[model samples]
Target: MSDQQPTGSDLSPPGESTSDTSPSRTAQLKRWAALDTTSGALLLTAATIAVVWANSPWRDSYQDLLEIEFGPAALHLHLSLADWIADGMLAIFFFVVGVELKHEFVAGTLRDFKLAGVPIVAALGGMIVPAACYVAVVGIGDPEALGGWAIPTATDIAFALAVLAIFGRGLPVALRTFLLTLAVVDDLLGITVIATFYTDTINLPALLGALVAVAVFAVLVRMARRWWLLLLPVALTAWTLMHASGVHATIAGVLLGFSVPAVAMRGERMPRTEWFDETIRPYSAAVALPVFAFAAAGVTVVGTSGIIQPVSIGIMLGLVVGKVVGVLAFTALMVRFTPLRLPDSIGLRDLLPVGMLTGVGFTVALLIAELSFEVGSDSHAAAAKAAILAGSVVSAAIAAVLLRWDARQLRDPDMNRDGIPDVDRDVIGG
Candidate 1:
């Protein structure tokens, strides 16, 4: 995912550590993956390098790299390097999203209608306002550009959570959970937008095949615990058929995720969902997302004029300003009027940063942009990508500042936000 290139050479001298404390390479990786900001930093670094590569004098190499295609052509599998990452690797990320969604709905606080309704409703508002902003902005100038209205409707869960975890250290866990639920719901809505508004054609026969494979996978997974290796082929079959069916291949991931049972099986001590999360989420975070970001974010600079075009500006406005307004406004109204309530020690002030965090729409926004505009090199595509990058940066920066402020001003050790202080709270960055 590092452009398939090695990164950040180590130059410092080796430091001494206690023999007992020294961990295995796998252990180190697992801990690093758990660091909360590691994935976000990796994503940002890959994206920054991609952007620089796209703009540099050796930009031709960048294009060549992306154009390199592989996979069997007969099975309709021949695809460019970009397609491989966007459609293939990105599915792993969505799979993680699916797991989180399923877990939240089945066993987490989201099961409660009143508690879940806040984020669910806020997510809808977040999507609606941004789409409206995009349509209003571009439709007024270049009506054709309105096709990209869904670009800013997504909130990259990883990126948003990373910002919150790093900068909002003292904030209650409720805030993080709220954002997670909200972002997951937001992405679900975004995927719906993709599946509904963007898909122009369908192959019903292949779609049916995909559903069957998904159902088979669902049953096979729950039937036994050691059936994991066998499940791979079924999952791939589902993905391939869904891809051929003209529906987005990533939907297969969500479907497969929905297939996994939340309850523990016969011999399992924990639920399969948690097991899958522990097993696969690290890869998704470290590899899948960063790779997708690298491929999605490599928008070449054409000129300032195109970069700041009306369509581009509209995307930026929708992502930055529109997401904040939508999330904050809907959440405020919900908390004020309805029986739905936020966790204790959290207030509207807490939601201000959360609102800003929701605006950090990077990976999913970029995906929608590609789907919105024509594939390959196009001025409109370039402008939309540039705008998404810009908007995401602005949103993350503002959210970080606000989260830091909130942490300092409203520091509370109530990690779970249940009005009771958690004595076992983890030390920040430990």
Candidate 2:
């Protein structure tokens, strides 16, 4: 979390770790943070454009564009632009996620169990409560809609961090770190859910082929030679096989990422994994994600009837109400009952807004909604999209207000000017 060099040999590779002296690595991370903020803006713009196009008179054109397919048909690779974006481009995003997760678990804050426990528990609670809420609302009457329980369990890292950057200028650095850790854990859980629950019928031969390709990729990367050229073909082959194996092709990206070494060689200035993330992160954030949002976020609202459907209400409640309640309650329980400790700069009150901000489940929620139901066709899918958009917007708005107020409280420790910091008085019910 401090961006300091890692200490343990288990985290570092065979040679000396370059984490401390790698100026290029630090610069790349800075660039990534800056681009992450910009990408959030771009994603919102793309989603807005999709909504307008979907609701406009030329909505048919949007559907036509999404349906256009142009991949090689012989290999069963022919897919719509939307499918390519979801399955191919999104792999790049998940690859970056895998890199970050590896870094966290191996050398970052998560390497210390004490430091990792809080966010990990918070993320688990955040995921479980929302899913429970969704099922409670939609499962009894419509079991088919239960597939979308995972939709609200995600936290859009870019969007949530963008809001923090915009509204949390004077807040403690610990808050940002907490949010990052929580989001990272949230992503890991989401990935597990996708791989475990969403996978359909397995193709044993294709899956075995994918494993072979991945093994070859791992060996090639360990050689630390000009493996990119060789690995590219191997990666593609693996992806194709995974696609054919009924497992999501994006899992291939995470697998390939984990195969890369997290520590630098004796002479190298940066880890291969860091370099790869630096190079590909921009493409994923700026182009891949925005394109996916454009393709996936468009939803035609049929009327009030569609908007009030159980799926719509369930997603909304799961995101807006369930997320906030779950994150805050679980975090408080952890601090009170467990050994987890909050940073001195952060207090119980500070987490309230952070919990609410976790509700802004935009990008991944939309992706899961698409996976949950028929895309661009099912009435339920349309309602789910509408709910995701609406719920994200409402959550963002509420978090903005709460964060702004918290910022003010940080700036002025005493609201009534009667001395005795206002936060203590409020907490004590004075």
Candidate 3:
């Protein structure tokens, strides 16, 4: 290192900072975005921090910060910071989900009913039973709580996959793929519930306007494939109109996502659907998901009856017990009673961890919890969110244990359940 005099260009005047931060800041953001599609460690950390912050002495600041409002009033885009994150940033997340779902239907595993039926049936069972469990638990004490029956029905694909990736060493690829397909279906169902049941009064004109915007967006993405960035304004318009139409703004994301062509056109290595996912999914995972978790999971641990509350208890039961029973029972019922066949080498034993994984509903469940109650039902919302967090953690822990056991079992060929060596799977760590 050399001792050098400060150059005039390097010197800043008092009270003024030097240099453009945009480039460095933009690059740092890109680095952070790259972490999204990984193990979801960042998302979990955000939730943990939110819980800690909410219970801290400065808890009021957390709430206040979420409630702070901004945006252009001209287009009625003004909304609280939390609403923006939930409504706007989460729209991005849903868009990515839509793209994935389209790919599955068009070219991926869902293209074959025989291969996809088991997980599809399992996804249905997983969703239905949890909602049933929630209703049973919450209905007796509070019939109104039925609105949140769908809360525990969702599976946080990112969180679930992260757990599996970490602990499911030597597991069959089929199991991982099963979870992915199940999650994709679960997301579709979750989006449907939001659109069908959760929506309030409709604004026909605005909804029509949103639909028109989505059509334009669809056309542009295919025709103007080389100018994909130009679709942002149209996408924003759809999101805005959807918000104005009393529908969840995130649905706009789903529509926009669905509008994208799934197959790669001639001369392209991958479809625009994948290209869009590659571009936006990282930011969705790293930024939208964690921020949403932080905002949604900051409920007070002791609020309302908390874990003891009917809604909270119901959600926990639905996520933990309901998911396991639903997946196992419904899957068995379908395979045995119906013509739907389980894929090769996957036994009933294989589904235990799969069911538990579905119970990890950290992200979407919280969104539903928020939508379940009317604004100002703070105590109820708090209880529901607390339940989701607790349920997800418990479910994840259970799944990890089950997965590790299965992996260990696979390590010993003698412990194989079917008395046959499976050639298709990798042992744990393979």
lDDT of every predicted structure (CA atoms):
0.79, 0.79, 0.81
Backbone clashes under 3 angstroms, per model? 0, 0, 3
- Residue-level lDDT of model 1, residues 91-161, one tens digit each, is 99888777767877888757888777888888988888988998888988889777888888899888887
- Clashing pairs for predicted structure model 2, backbone only: none
Minimal lDDT window, size 10, model 2 = 1-10
User: In terms of TM-score, which candidate is strongest?
Assistant: 1
Off by over 4 Å in 1: 1-24, 302-305, 410-430
How are the candidates ranked when ordered by TM-score, highest leading? 1, 3, 2
TM-score of each: 0.90, 0.87, 0.88
| Colliding residue pairs in candidate 3 | 169-428, 170-427, 170-428
List where candidate 3 sits over 4 angstroms from the true fold: 1-39, 302-307, 411-423, 426-429
- How many residue pairs in model 2 have overlapping backbones? 0
User: Alpha carbon lDDT of residue 252, candidate 1?
Assistant: 92
Model 2 misplaced stretches (Cα beyond 4 Å): 1-34, 302-305, 411-430
Candidate 2 lDDT over 161-224, as tens digits, reads 8788777767776677788899989988898888888887899999899989989998887774
Task: Name every residue pair that clashes in candidate 1.
Answer: none
